[model samples]
Target: MTLAWLCLMWVFLSATVATLPLRIQFIPGAILLVAGPVLIIVIGLQVGFVFSVIALAAYVSMFRNPLLFLLARLRGRKIEVPR
Candidate 1:
């Protein structure tokens, strides 16, 4: 679980940084390039499916796309009730 969380954090941070100005983004990417392998080797880090779910939530919140959010909510509701 810890490994998965770390991987998710790294990926989320990397993507967030990439969307920033090049000057700010490059440093993190370089750091990740250098440290990523170490993280995998030392911790067996990997992102989990939960990160994607959270990311989608964030995207919906930021974009306020009612259609997508409604669909997602419906899907989630179906899963929970299964009716």
Candidate 2:
């Protein structure tokens, strides 16, 4: 029950962030990006690996662009952000 609520809240927050300007979305989006994996781990512990994997795939799809940008930075590649 608690996990379900948290997942719902996460989805709601993500949708809200999507509506904001790109620059403004970064802070909250970044927080969510960090929180997501932790939440997945907890969910795995509570539920099971299969559900956690599904959640991870969904999360990756949802945050693909931000994840890609972070990956580029980690790899020492320059990524241009659109203004």
Candidate 3:
């Protein structure tokens, strides 16, 4: 129950941060990016794997571009971000 509320709040907060300018979003965006996996794992342990999988899908959907960029970087592809 508490985890569900936290997940909802996280989504809303992420959406709010997303509306900020790129420069302004950097810090908060990074924070949310980092917090995501930890939250997912904690919730999964508390709840169940199915819910965590759903949450992971939502998280990936929301952070698609960034995650792709990260993957590309790991694969040694040169990528650029707009200012």
Candidate 4:
């Protein structure tokens, strides 16, 4: 029950972030990016690795752009923000 609620909340928050303008989405998006892995860990412990992996896939798909940007920054590549 709790895991289901958390998943739903994650989906809702992700959807809300998607609706906002890119600049405005940054803070909440970053919060979700940080929280996502912790939730995946808890989900794995509560349920199983398979379910956790599925959740992680969903998370990665939803945040692909931000994740890619972070990766680029980590690699010392320049990221250009479109106007």
Index of the highest-lDDT prediction:
2
| Model 1 lDDT on a 0 to 1 scale | 0.57
Q: Model 3, 30: alpha-carbon shift in Å?
A: 1.0
The TM-scores, one per candidate, come to 0.45, 0.95, 0.89, 0.93
Every model's Cα RMSD, please? 13.4, 0.7, 1.3, 1.0
lDDT of residue 25 for candidate 4: 86
Ten residues in sequence with the least summed lDDT for candidate 2? 22-31
Over 10-72, each residue of candidate 3 has an lDDT whose tens digit, in order, gives: 889999999999889878988899999989998899999998899899889998988899899
What's the ranking of the predictions by TM-score, best on top?
Answer: 2, 4, 3, 1
Candidate 4 lDDT, 1-83, residue by residue in tens: 98889878988998999899988988998999999999999999999999999989988998899899999999999999764
- Top candidate on TM-score is 2
Candidate 3 lDDT (Cα, 0 to 1):
0.91
Question: Which pairs of residues clash in candidate 1, taking residues 3 or more apart in a chain or in different chains?
Answer: none
Winner on lDDT between 1 and 3 is 3
lDDT of each: 0.57, 0.94, 0.91, 0.91
lDDT of 4: 0.91
